[model samples]
Target: MIKHHPSETLLAQYCSAQLPASLSVAVSIHVDMCPVCQAKVAQLEAENAKEVFSESQLSSSTVKNSHDTEEVDFGTDLLNLITADPSIDEVYEVEPVTIQVNEHNYELPRALTRISHGRFTQVGKLARSRVAIDDGPLRSSLLHIGAGGEIPEHTHTGFEVTLLLDGEFSDEEGSYVPGDFIWQDGSHQHTPLTKNGCLCFTVVSSALHFNKGLSKLLNPIGNLIY
Candidate 1:
């Protein structure tokens, strides 16, 4: 069961295609694993459709001297625009992509497999590999943390979103299992630990800022690693 979820505002932004690409991907992947969020997104979409239809009807009633070429099908166009992107609602069991780590293979979330290009780069001494996906304003990665691994206590400068894909991990708040969506900002700081290991898809707008201990030394070079 997923204990954490993207807020209703975030889900509404996702439904309206108003979120940035990286954040959008995070929400989409969460929806893939969480039916509750999926249903919420669907309801938002329906409400949007209703608003568009109402506006279209009002516009059509006020139109005068309209030519065939000048007239536009607002409802059709809006519906197409809303539903055209399969990333939001498509079922992706046709072609699954898997990545290997420490002699073990893990299947990536469908939303991630589309943008990862099947590449992972090793980072740190722990069993972790960061698969990069650039999304303009945000930096996205697929992070794999092996058993007993820990991410040093750190805070964020901007915003960070993490979507758990496999296994379990715990932090100051609680333990997060697959499909859990965690959001962090500058004011938050915690060390993430995995007992049985876990794989996560993460999006960060800025490099993580380590708050204490020896990890603070890496602050100067954090951008290179985070």
Candidate 2:
């Protein structure tokens, strides 16, 4: 019963490999958890493949008479590229990785398991683990909110994307469960809180701007903590 999803435009960009690494990873993790999005991505990929095949066929037809040598087989070349590694076995498997926060353990999504993440940095009831992805100003991390934890009301200077990995959380907007993909920009501001606790995968393009009284002082170290 996942309600939030990446926009269709975002999904298209993801299918075409047009998004930045951090955003792409966020969308990928969402697709891993959402069956609806998984099917949509599959359809988009098929359509893209069809278009590429059609263009390749047209190019091959136009060059058929001009070449004296045998025509290169693109499909064979692709197959060779896929199976070029001699050490690759007939089967491959990857074990899931788990993270611990406040004595609670949660398994990471398959997409995240492939990437490297650093140690967690704790600040009161909140903890954040930076994901090692170099995408210029875009920062990615795993944010864990312990029970009764709450983030101060803040607006984004650029953009923020959060994918709920486990548990539930709520804001001025509404409650979000696991697999919810929440996107926010400078126009939106809210304080997020969890009752039972929650773990989220988040990516931020820039530092946050706290709106409340004393919390505004945290604006300087927003990027470090979030």
**Where does candidate 2 clash, by residue pair?**
none
Compared to the true structure, candidate 2 yields what TM-score? 0.89
The per-residue C-alpha lDDT of model 2 at residue 197 equals 94
Predict model 2's lDDT versus the native. Answer: 0.90
- For 1-226, candidate 2 gives per-residue lDDT tens digits of 8999999999999999999999999999999999999999999999998987775674574323245665645665545645898766566577888877779999999888878999888989999999999999999999999999999999999999999999999999999989999999999999999999999999998899999999999988877755
The CA root-mean-square deviation of candidate 1, after full C-alpha superposition on the true structure, stands at 4.2
lDDT of 1 by residue, 1-226 (tens): 8989999999999999999888888899999999999899889999997886787584574322245545445556545756888776865465788778777688977776656444566655255444455567687777878888899999998888989998899999988989999999998999999888888888888889999989899899977765
Lowest summed-lDDT stretch of 10 residues in model 1?
Answer: 61-70
- Which predicted model would earn the best TM-score? 2
Score residue 170 of candidate 1 by CA lDDT: 98
